[model samples]
Target: MKRRTLLRATGGAVLGGSVGLAGCLDQFSDSESGDTDSHDFPADYETETFDGQTVPFAPLEDVAEWWENDEARFVDARTQVQYDEAHIEGAVFSPSPDGLESADPVAEWDTDTRIVTYCVCPIAQAGQRAATLLDNGYTDVYGLADGFNPWRENGYPVESNDGQASLSTYEIEGETDPADAGEYALAVHPETGQREASRIDADGGYELSLHFVDVPDSSLLELRTPSYELEGTIEEFSSATVQV
Candidate 1:
């Protein structure tokens, strides 16, 4: 969605009054002066609409500029493991739906503050996180258009704990009871502190995506849903089908 909603002010002069609206004009001038210090995003950015929520998607190029200037708060929407492995430097690790928890730095930001969110899935998780911010009354929020993959691939600034470790994405999907629709599905690795969450679709299906960095085959993973939980090794979980 390459569109912008510009605010317009309409006014007319009253000829009969000799005294001008000086106080109101002064107040408006002060507000305008204050706004000049705040950062503004360009109008040509894209947007994504998911699950009835819409959020603007700013290209990595633009985001990089903001990052360099420290003009926006960067939020990593990936799991703790993914974030720990690699993330845009200085990014806050705040996963979606739970992003605004008191523990996250974003929780302390003002509603008018500029925020950018990103995930390895490119726009999927980032879009969700940005939408969540919009729902929470964040006026200026954007999703990193191509996400962390491109940023990392293009050699942008990033903080990595295990740069030599190979990163892999695994998608585990299965059906759930109809009653469990709208609930959350989570994949958790207790030892590594890796966790991923996805909302169960209305059709009783869900795909929980996990990003791992050199995860051991013997590592235990807990696949959990509102109705049931299954524990198995990482290899087992990669091929297992969750049914509840």
Candidate 2:
């Protein structure tokens, strides 16, 4: 499915308060702080308390180190659209606005899981998400100090739906052909019981191109038609470039 269509179908779900892009970018403006060239940590950046616990800010440099060592789980706190466009490799999507009100993707993670939440809005949105995670018993939650833009500017690794790691095509074949299978859904399950659906073209020959990030290696991909269902492992499909 195209990234845009998927985002639209999801109602542009944002994890935090629905701040406009201009407002988010304003965090970097010279008028806001009189220093435009420096990515220095803001002195006024204060600690926020949630459930009587303070959420600490994780420096971009430290987070980058953790990312390289694969020691911390990165959570994107922006809207799904922003996440789809670009995010740190392996970061999970957990929008703040919805995260506080409902069970998010990370809800089932171990309480000791190391997590860092980030957004272009920098503080308000990301901080709220970190606080929420902390309140939920995630002990090592931290907000990315200074947010995504600075990290991107520093040439750190980023992944996007448009990138090579995210683009893959597969052919679906089964007793019930998708062209005639009305209103079917195609989903990828990265973990057991967790399914993220992809957009399907009913008119096409059941050929689906998906972002690889949505279907990590070893994940399960399932196609559900009205009368039949077909499932395959991502490795199996990648092996042959087609599945039956």
Candidate 3:
């Protein structure tokens, strides 16, 4: 969706750059920052809670097919780095469960269609994504279990959103080291501008499991990047899988 498609969308280049460049740039936010929406979720994991709450996950295939023809909403639940690597087609980059009501917040929705959400893999984060939609009165809310991995695993279409906020990825880095696996988890969504992730997995593992959730989950939500080595467990859950 390029602004150039609109006749009045662009004027001529101004002294600085162009008349269309200054006031119209922010007119492009399309996530769910402050509205109501809904969709369907995959079926897999169960709902659990410790710090906040971790919901079960849904199958990726079932979810993709569900919205393949339907005009359902889509969201990415991973950090910016992970999302930049790859994401489902036509999905916005709002890590928040609700998409709207977020720091960066999605700014648009059809409302009539259902809204679906996902994260690196979709289990607890999907629940978090649903919470936002439900709270905003969106009845048709859901998560895409097995997130991007499943989509790519089956040779489904995926894209890279370098900087489209609405369809951009997040960056889940930590200022400090993370606890053992299964003990606690933290994540960040760069697309939505929600610096702190609340909804997480609390019962997937135990302290013996490195004070984190499952090994995969821990790795996904622990660090923001590999080269920098941000502070966190960086578990590699099926939901939030990273290529590198």
Candidate 4:
């Protein structure tokens, strides 16, 4: 199946020099923010909340300029199959959870290099990866605010394979022991380490949307948290009354 094509059609906020727990760049407007005639890269872009963190956001326009001038490296934070289907022209696939570990290309880049992370679900996975990078000392990182769809839709540069299956969202929802509240629930693809994570809420509930290309109901996944790990097939996850 091709991607579901459910795109978010909303404008996003701009970027700042530093990231905080939560805040937004004032929504850009010529009338409100005075003259809007600056081309400064990060300032020109917007901000958005993704994956429970405030990350810098770059819209397509700023990203296009960065692409042409070689100002930033792009990272695809989706699954390998999603990357193989279609991605920005030169994005490297380094799906979250293990994005920059071991042999990932981004690991070799200088800590100060400008990096941008993106995923089709707007910015959740991308923001998670970008947040990881920033926490580990990357100087400049941003999540693609509108994600890959806008770039592809507007006919920007991309690399793609023919006849590949598009992505679909696989959801896993459950409640854990109340003691586990404030921890995380992660769904990990056993093979690729592609993952989705959500914080266990105060009531011990969590839900995750794992995006993949051509996932079978019998495919293995690891549902994990700090205290326990449960392994099961996608079909099993759908029915399991997991309480740990």
How do the predictions measure up, each by TM-score?
Answer: 0.63, 0.47, 0.47, 0.61
Q: lDDT (CA) for every model shown?
A: 0.64, 0.52, 0.40, 0.63
Error of 3 at 7 (Å): 55
Off by over 4 Å in 4: 1-54, 59-65, 68-70, 97-103, 107-112, 120-125, 146-157, 161-163, 239-244
Estimate, for each residue in 1-244, the C-alpha lDDT of model 3 and write its tens digit: 1111111212221111000000111111111233221233334333332123223334556677766776566777544544665677777776544343456444456444576677543244554665655655566656565445556768877887554333223333122122222222333322332222222122222111111111232232322211222223333222233222
Q: Deviation in angstroms for 6 in model 3?
A: 55
Q: lDDT score of model 2?
A: 0.52
TM-score of candidate 4 to 2 decimals: 0.61
Off by over 4 Å in 2: 1-46, 49-53, 98-103, 163-244
The weakest ten consecutive residues by lDDT in model 4 span: 13-22
Error of 1 at 116 (Å): 0.6
Q: How does candidate 4 score on lDDT?
A: 0.63
> Candidate 4's error at 118, in angstroms?
2.2
Give all candidate RMSDs, comma-separated: 17.7, 14.6, 16.8, 10.7
Number of the candidate with higher TM-score, 1 or 3: 1
Tens digits of per-residue lDDT for model 4, 54-169: 46778778888999999999998877767887889989988763474468989888988889888753245676677677667777788777667778889989997646676566
> What lDDT score is found at residue 6 in candidate 1?
16
